[model samples]
Target: MRRSGATLDFDVDTTSGHPLYIPNGDLLTANKWHHVVFTWDGNVTGTNAKWYVNGVNKTLANIAGSGSRTSDSGYSPYIGALCSGCYFNGQIDEVRIYNRALSAEEIKRLYLLGN
Candidate 1:
């Protein structure tokens, strides 16, 4: 997912041939900092993925299709933006990527730390 200005974008492509795309919405306030966290279990089902904005879980009502969440050899993680475009306009700090999925409590702690 990526954000441009206040608009947020979400996308998912499963080898099932059907891809999932979420509607664009305001995920950030102008000139204000926000804490955002995204997580996925690498599970085959999309149900295990999550989006956390300011420590609260956001709904993913638009998600559809089914496929493994296992890492794809074609894609690598990008911290501030997508490969083609949708570059972020603000500062990104203390970015972290983990090999293991973090628990809810750990997410909360990290969010609280503002790191």
Candidate 2:
């Protein structure tokens, strides 16, 4: 996650690699409430990855890299901030991780529940 003034660039790292990187611009703003969802099924390519904001599918955005993910980084996921110097400008509510990719319906329900 990177925030500069009014620009916010979000990235959803996949075990396969860095298949998710939302460019800096309109998809995400500087200050606002949002619910982000990223899903990638097992052994999938970058094109198969999916991400959403507020239940709206944003997977249409450009996703870099290709090929299947054979393994995940041994490191644990660090959200909101990649490191001490890279703290997210805003706040985060909650984060949940599942062993399997959630269906679109499930993601939408989560968004509805938040609202």
Question: Which of the numbered candidates is closest to the native, going by highest TM-score?
Answer: 1
Q: How big is the positional error of residue 61 in model 2, measured in Å on the Cα after superposition?
A: 2.9
Reference-based lDDT, each prediction: 0.66, 0.64
Runs in model 2 lying further than 4 Å from the true structure: 1-17, 23-25, 42-44, 66-74
What are the RMSDs of all candidates, in order? Answer: 3.1, 3.6
lDDT by residue (tens digit), candidate 1, 1-115: 6775675555555667534434335677878787777777655355676777777767655556576444467887655677657577788876778887777788888888875
lDDT for 68 in candidate 2 is: 50
Clashes of 2: 0
**Judged by lDDT against the true structure, how good is candidate 1?**
0.66
Model 1 misplacement above 4 A: 4-13, 17-25, 68-71
Q: How many backbone overlaps does candidate 1 show?
A: 1
